[model samples]
Structures are given as structure tokens and as C-alpha cells.
Target: MFMRRSHDFTFTGWHMAGVVCLFFGTIISVNVYMAYQAVHSWSGLVVENTYVASQQFNGKVEEAKHLAASGLSGTLTVGAGMIRYRMVDAADRPVDADELTVRFKRPVGDHQDFELLLSPVGSGVHEARREVLPGHWIVEVTGLKSGERILHHSKRIAVTGPAS
Candidate 1:
């Protein structure tokens, strides 16, 4: 009876060790899977958001191309006083609309930029009050139709201060 009881005790000890090992293994596996999913989830969000934003600009590019095909030309000039822009639409007609937006490229990077909306004062002319730093910039113009963009145009400009 003594030998039988000792044998039962040894078996119980081994079983408890096995149970502890299994519990720890399960926890480690779950942690690894969560880390893997976190990395993949963020990249998926970045790709999806970029795609959706680009789709919104598709129609605006098409409209700009259409206007350009009809001998329409525009000019964007940036200086110390104010940022000025002009747009000539198709059929040799000047475009003056209340829904024009102007965006200036910030010095940080291409993705980080500032945008300003200009008010149209006369035929084909738009003006905005901008206090921009002295640097090179890319100016982008967009036409909004009922809050949706319908045309886009871009140009490069440089702002410089007086010689010291």
C-alpha cells in the first residue's frame, strides 16, 4: 500500500507540470498572434485610406484636362502681398466661380501641406491672403461643385524676400 500511494503521488506531480506548461504555451501563442495582427492592420488602413482619397480626385483631374484641351490656360503667382491665380476655361472664356480652393505645399514634405480657399473677385481672377514663408512651393487649384471637387490645377512658385 505504501508503494502504491507513492506511485500515485508521482503521477499527479507530472500531470500538474504538464498542465502548467500547456497554459503558458497557449498564452505565448495568443500574444504572438496579436502582435502579428497589429502590424498588418495598420498597413491595411493606410493603403485603404490612400485609395479612397485618390478616387475622390479622379473627376477633378478629368475636368481640368477637358478645360485645358479647349485652349484654356491658367497662371499662379505667389509674392509678398498676396497669392494670385487666374483661370481661363474652355471656349476662350474666363472662369470666375465661388468654389475655388488653393493649396500651398509646406516645406516639411509633399504629404504635409496647407490649403487655402480663395474668393473670386472678377472674371478669371481669384485672391487670397497668405502669409507664406520664403521658400519654393507648389500651388494647386481645385474647383468645387456643391462641395465636391470637379477640377484641379497645379503650378510651382517661389517666394523670396528682399536682398539683405
Candidate 2:
């Protein structure tokens, strides 16, 4: 029994250094990977001309306020690769415009952004067929009359499941 010997696994500086390296290395690697993905997927600028946009910002706000004051609003519905846009005015009647410009953007990635020119179906209603890939999409529709942007409405819609 006295000859039965067991080796002790002693903790040392090398073990400590290895643990520290592993703990910090994983964090650093994850951070670097996330940063790279964001940088590659992100557009460099949200606004082309910051100064010009800032200068005209107030005017745009006023325009929006005026439109709201007029009780101009819209309802947007999306389903099955289709979009139904209905515009209404203060009297709760459908508003009519010649054409509409629809912008579809994916919130996460940059590859699936697209634009569509929708045609009017009836007074205050427009329909368009757009291949809405299954994902989170930011839908923006601007009612245009005589080639001028009049009513701007935006909504976020999620199309679930794998890309169809």
C-alpha cells in the first residue's frame, strides 16, 4: 500500500496563460468577425449630401405636417408577392394619384433592395406585383402626381420562411 503512488496535477503559469488566451481570443475573434460583416454589408452613406439634406429638412417636415393636417393617410398591405396600397384624404374618401413609387428594402442585408413603379387601379387604390423575398422588409410608398412626390407612407413587414 505504501508503494501505491499518484501523480498530482499541479496548476502552473502556462495553464493560466492558456486559459486567459482562450477566454480573450474567442471574444476578440467574434468581435472582429461581426465588425467585418457589418462593414461589408453596410452602405457607406445614408445620405448623399448631408448639408443639402439638413438644409431642406425643415421644408420636408413642414410638408409632412401640412399633409397630415389635411388628414391624408394611407394603408399598405402585403401578401403573397403582392402589395395593396390605398390612400385616403381628410373626408375618409379614397385619394387618387397618377402613379406611385414603391421602395422595398431589407433591414438586415443590402442585397435585396429594389424599387417598383406601381400603377393606379382605381381612385385611392394601387396594385403592384413585387417579388417580396421572405424576410424583414421596409416598405416605402410615395404617391406621385404629375411626377411629384405627394404622399409618403412607410411600413415594416416581415415575410417569414425561407426565400421563395
lDDT of 2 by residue, 45-158 (tens): 677899999999999999888766767788887777677788998788998888887898877666779998777889788888865778788988888778776788878988
Error of model 1, residue 64, in angstroms: 5.6
The Cα error of candidate 1 at residue 152, in Å, is 0.9
Winning candidate number (TM-score) = 2
Candidate 1: clashing residue pairs, number: 0
Model 1 C-alpha lDDT per residue in residues 1-48, reported as the tens digit of each score? 445454443457789899999999999999999998876544333344
On lDDT, the leading prediction is: 2
Q: After superposition, how far is residue 79 of candidate 2 from its true place, in Å?
A: 2.8
lDDT of 1 at 31: 97
Q: List the residue pairs that clash in candidate 1.
A: none
